[model samples]
Target: MGLFPTSPPRIIAQHLQLDLSIRNYRTPAALSTQKYADLRNEHTFPPFAALPEELDPDLSYYEMSGFREFKHSRHWCFLAEISKVEWLARLRLVVRDKQGALVPVAFYTDDKGEEFKYRARKGSTVMILYPDQHFFLGGTTGIRLEKESFCKIVTAPLNELMALSDRVGRYSTWQAGGRTCHGCDEKKVVDLQKCAGCGMFWYCDKTCQTTGWQSKGHKRDCKLIRENGLRAMFLTDRDRFEHFIDFLLPEPVTASESTAAAVEKLSALSIGTESGGSRAAEQTAVIVKTPYKIQPIASKGKGMVASTWIPRGTRILSEPPLFRVPRDNPDISAVDDIVVSKVSQLSAEQQRVFFDLTNIHGTEHSTAMGIARTNVLPLGSDSRSGGLFPIASRINHSCRHNAQNTWNDNIGRLTIHALRDIKWGEEITICYLPTVGSYRERQNRLRATFKFTCTCELCSLPCVYSRWESDMRLRKLQKLDAQIPGLLWGDRVEEKTALGLVRSMLDLFREEGIQDASIARAYNDAYQLALTCEDECRAKVFAQRAWEARCVAEGADSPTAVKMKKAVDQREHVKVPELDEDAFEKWLWMEGES
Candidate 1:
């Protein structure tokens, strides 16, 4: 099909001609004849003269008709002006159609109407494509906009858009035989210079162009046409719809390039980095083969399972957030708006993956917001913001997780490392809790915060005695953890006592089978305590252990791991008598002294 219906040009021109004739015939008898004459003289060319004689043949076109002519079965495309905006439980726009009828336009997108909140203002012209009448539950019929790609908001009013369209049709189309000068109304056989601003209107000379700009409202029209890219949209074919398109739509991606692009964009933010230039670029350069695959677990909806044997200390995955949300925002509506805006910025494929993520919040929040709230991982332990990672989000939670996730600020990505050897087909899991706790405490927190019951291997220990012993060890570890912090920079506790508390926490970690970053953190705490006591030999051993543990949990590239490595390397070497493992442990902890 050609751009717009073949008959629209003739039909619109006839309608304009008839309207002008009627106005002219009634002008002499009216008391406002002189006012009308003055208004007519203000413009050099009549409005109808702006209308083109022909439409482009490359694009498909729909009839330029009123909403009243629309049928429920057929898809319709048209332009309307927003008369009123309703921000209630749902966003609704009351628009004035070409027939002057008020029609409701309701948004049913993933973010509801929040995606269009910026542009859904009174008098803004909305260009809608393939819209169908929606029968509301309240017995009202209105247009439903389900996909963001199917609509665009031109910041100008509807009447102004009509005028712009007319101008674009008249001047933008190329004619081999001759072109009409917009200012002089003279046909030129030779090529005419086009207006530099809009590049739509042609002029025979500089003087004529100036006349067109000042006398024919070309100045305002030129600005609107150039700013909005109105002429390109008119020339481009938009008959086919595929995925959701947004304002200032990016260049189309081929099917072959889309998968890689989506993975790169969704997995990494590529923003400011400490060491690497862009996290996305660094990851792209070193293509780490995925060791896990997303599949359904028995109780969990979807989880990442090992596709191959993943050894301990191996980096499973490193990913950046698809989008980030502020963690401290108390206003639910404001948060929803933020999520909607971020989601709208993603590519169509990335958006689909984002929406497919788990939404534990359910009906309480919008779909986009719910997915964000359910899957967001903190940028760091004490971060003010959290991000949603597409692949990392699919890893299910386990009390006894075989892998650990740490936010590495140096690379600006979340790195996942295997804490234990994961057999082929085994599920790769991560602990979601901030700290290890007793069975009851862990269950309560998981159930309340994540809306799920813990049934991981640790939580499902068959023997009651085993469970009890595990809880006791965890309680002792928590108590030791609390006491170690106070002794860090204070004279409240003796130096030996502070080192002993951290050593006890490490012992409990072994007894409790905690192989995550907590073990590394405990060793670091012990290293700090030894340094405070000016024990270089003991501090070297503690720092080495901290470095090793951190490397296994957060990878060697982690900032904390690098710092621990530096601490271990920078200290002076101390000569001591060669001893066995048991004797070395006693000496490192200074057990024989006191």
Candidate 2:
């Protein structure tokens, strides 16, 4: 609860400046002479060892147990040879430092922090900056590394950097640096070294650089590059996983141009700016014309409103994740910190969107991490990992939602589509609880976890006596979801019975007001059952339903959507001429009864 500064100590930042400059990455000049020099005043982190041990009451018990807390954590840099490092549960790690020191760097998820897998080794020369001291009760004590913290693992001597030219040369941005002329994107420029003032961009000559300063957009970009520590983003190869080795580390990738391009893309994404490639707003605008507008939701701070009536099967929004962390939960604390770092990278408007999100964990945890927990929607099927989409986040929680949210991996964006026709002026919503249950169960889960009592239609029912049908439908839905796997997996199953159960499940979903990704999956199960039984007519119907369900859940462009489309297409010509549509419907469900 007490404040610990996030900024690195002067000594640590200075050390980083030296390492980066010597390695020919983010040079010293670039670090010291930031365009916005006032940014330096933002660091109020005290010198190493400033915070006294007396204030933290539980300090002695932890230190006595060899899990000493580093109260003065900022800029406490150490050139340590790792004697031992263990990957503990929840991503907390314990490492023995060279100076007979043992510290715990607790909590790192597989996002930007995943880089540690390559760095933390038995005998690697690792330099960690701004890690708070931490001591556990059972002799496992070390520094706690936050998401903003970084470590530079010296795989090769600074003198030998030139030897890695072949590998580094592949990164086009590295070769150009600030030397690339902003006016023409040319590296052949003469005297196009660092910009004399900000040290962020380069130009061919005084005239070209001036044109860049005035017209080519470098004038605006130079300020952002200085503030965002974009040089750090530029120097690190996000994909190059070179493990730290004394003998033969993998190819030394000096930098990644892809990361630089991403940073540039973000920098260009100013409010009211023209829409361009891969920008989140532009891509979403393509599908839903003037899709939605953010407005105040009285009790809930803000919510997404249906600007116009959005029809079922419409892909309302498709956008890249504001930030994505690995779906793993080695430690909740470590993952949360990494999420904070990613949020820090968003543009002004993007940050505004993120900060404006509702956090149910108010006053309990870090602001950014809390909002992430409250707003993050699952990105993958297993729901192991997730992402934050501001537009989707605005659609508040309800037990019976008006809209369905899905993560479309093909497009790499979370898509929110109207499950039914969402009328204008209506507040769009998404169900937060995993699966709908009895009224009491839904209420307890939402209240305990999200810290709010849900008053959606299902929860708003007068009493158990009056809402018998709703409760019965919810109970049946829960039971069906549980029994589905066993029903599908059985060797000697009754195909007709399984089909009937699937049909009942769909009916229950409708009765319970459930419009979810699971609906598409349920239809898929029905499609499989009909196909295995050689009921082509029924299979085609189920497949078409699955296709439409997914079109409203996943995007129309997704592979599953395309496959379902084909299933319906393949059956267009294969019709039994003897039976009409109603007769065929009776035939599919009545095979066992007959």
Candidate 3:
């Protein structure tokens, strides 16, 4: 269940996953999650950046998930040769990792595979983003093209980032001013540790230290570590992790010049930008943007306020999530712990902002999970994945929500658009319930899910007079839903029956103060029915009506609006000849088009 004060609106909730839990536990982290960097392995075989495999006893699927979790949050490098390419339904890149293990990397969804047709080739060198969906498990393909700034190809440099990940492994142990094993990557956590000759190098055993001096190259590396004052880096007791080092990819052409040369080479790839802006080819020129401000609400804590007049269909607020969690995962504690770990890595100021957000779980086991549950919005097509949008979350709940919250795939951002015009200074709101129902139903849902009774305009109508009329309309709307299918698909459909249903649904939407995508869709259905009868000019008017409704909710630049615009521009269809407006109505719906 959601942590918000109202039941999730019907439309939005249809795609969300809800897990209900009520428990509190106090568990402090055993180790601090700290700042980490993507460091290049200067020597040796690099650390083991193990991909999850069943036969490997040294690693578990759980640990591999954590390693992937760590890599997905920041910039990561992939080194591989394209072993196979499948371009038909989707872009699937099968590449061999540094270990010579073949892994499948899928990018983008269905129709988008064509955009990067040239890049998906055999034996091509590519640098995929760290967090990309590397479906290492059986059956499923890897990577999805839907994520932001998904990946880029470093055409010139080859295999520079293919080294094993040093970021993982033995990060748990740290000691300063004490002797530690120099030769051991798997040294025990405590006891039996002694220093070698220089008082700088440590080893667990005499034989190990001796071998390290000659065979493991500690002789040269030790002298360099001591002389260069890298002893601190060698130890793990420091309060903070090391900052990121600039490592150029593909061609570390002479290690010395790779820094400057790499940046120049990768400049066209837009390396550091969080998500693409103009880089997204599908986005149209924005007409108006969502505008709102955050302010303290009486007893509600903080709420989003419209800073200016927000027109219907204006994409009011489009923002990336601070972080995300697997939506369908039933384990609440695990998800909450992951969020907490991510928060620990943020700057103190950023941490404060995250901590200050509303928590429906007052003192529940997980404050992190509480805020996430209360504020999380869907990430993709469904609630199986969700991200917490800091600003969008603050837009308080209303039974009669003024805005529509959607996961906009084109921009890869959580977008809130005004479903209805919002006046300047008005408190911006979105519906928590999946759909508006009876007053009692709304009340019960709000109490059960959010633990607060809603006082929304539609929900607060008294049971004596106001509730009756609203409930009556709602029941009728439900009945209409069942009738429309038969009229649309049945062979003996009467034109008047379909027309009556459309008019009633339109009136019901208005009476309920509803502004939704369905309104436009319903009008489009009428246009299609007219088309079935070859009523061209009459269908144009219905098509125009559908387009107007769409413009008010999706804006003129949206894909749906663009498609509607194309239909409106097809003026050639109206050449069939126009009937008088009254006669047109009778012929179109009441009487058959004869």
- Per-candidate TM-score against the hidden true structure: 0.51, 0.49, 0.47
- Give the candidates in order of TM-score, highest first: 1, 2, 3
lDDT of 1 by residue, 214-321 (tens): 998899988886666454344322333332223333222234556657435422422212233222221211112356779999979999986554556677888888
All candidates: CA RMSD (Å): 25.9, 23.4, 23.8
TM-score between candidate 1 and the true structure = 0.51
Residue by residue across 1-594, what tens digits does model 2's lDDT show? 011111111111011111222223334333322221111111322221332222242221112211332222221233344554443122334444433455555443224245565455565444454344443222343554543234554443212222222112321233433334666666652455557544445567788778877986565555543432334433332222221111111112223446555334324432222234212221121112345678998887788886544545456666778888766787878887898789888888989878888887876778988888887788866867888877777778887787777777777877776776555567888877777778778888988988888877767787777578888887887787777667777776567788778878888887776777778999899888777777786787688778867766655667788888888778888664344334555665665473
What's the distance in Å from true for residue 335, model 2? 2.2
Candidate maximizing TM-score: 1
TM-score pick, better of 2 and 3: 2
**1-594: candidate 3 lDDT, tens digit per residue:** 111110000001001111111111111233223222223432211212443221122222122222212111122334566787654224667777556667676554324455555655666655442222333212353443333233444332234222212312222234342233556655454554434323334467777778778886556544543332222222222122112212121211133446555345435433443224312211211112235668998877789886554545566776777887788888877887888887777788877888888887777757877887877877754567888787787888888888877665555677677786555567888887776777788889988888888887787776668878988887787788678777877886566668778778878989988787768877887877676666676577677768767755655545566677677668545653334434555655666543
Model 3 segments beyond 4 Å from truth? 1-290, 345-347, 363-365, 380-383, 531-539, 557-559, 562-572, 575-594
lDDT of each: 0.67, 0.56, 0.54
In Å, residue 281's CA in model 1 sits off its true spot by 34
Summed backbone clashes in each candidate are: 2, 13, 23
